[model samples]
Target: MFQIGRIIMPSPLLRRLLAALVLVTLALPSAAAADCYVHYKAKRTNPYGLHYGIIRVSGGCPSSPGGLVQSRISSGGWTILNVVKVTTSSPSSSERRSAGSHYYR
Candidate 1:
């Protein structure tokens, strides 16, 4: 028997279930923060071109991934136009194919 605040938990099975639930709850955040996918559009002047691609971002997705996307593409002289979507899952095979050479593995 265990007393947690004003509640009495008398069953070992209940205690085990509660412990497992707590463990899962604690782990959810880290799992969610593990990886983020950013889909964006970018452009380059001079030669004049546009690109749509997806990139995997570590350290989780930010409220605004534009800056991060910009920095990642800017090295190639591409300027970020907009962040189309930010998600926790990887892009589908079709999405990846559409990105062509611009997709980051």
Candidate 2:
């Protein structure tokens, strides 16, 4: 109902809040997120043990090189997970993305 319906995220905080509001809509199992879905077969050579992930955006993800979702694996400590953005159909102009190293900076 989020992506297909009207979602009003007026500001960044509101957007985060709106996104948070929909978290309960998913029927996630604790063990399920441990296995994230990899859409691009070309990238996933060994698709055996991908760790957990949370769906931040609904429409697959933003179209950065990897796709529109981000994920991480946890051991004794959390591992560095890569975020991806993608589309099933041909992407539009807004879908293209460039990764920046200075995201946190």
Give the clash total for candidate 2. Answer: 11
Candidates' lDDT values, in order? 0.88, 0.35
Model 1's lDDT to the true fold?
0.88
Best by TM-score: 1
Tens-place lDDT per residue, model 1, 13-93, is 887999999999999989977889899999999789999989898878887799989988988889999989899888999
lDDT minimum window of 10 residues, candidate 2 = 96-105
Residue 95 in candidate 2 has what lDDT? 30
**Model 1 lDDT at residue 28:** 92
Q: In model 2, which runs have C-alpha deviations exceeding 4 angstroms?
A: 1-9, 28-105
Q: Who wins the lDDT comparison?
A: 1
Candidate 1 stretches with Cα past 4 Å from truth are: 2-11
State how far residue 80 of model 1 sits from its true place (Å). 0.8
TM-score of each: 0.78, 0.17
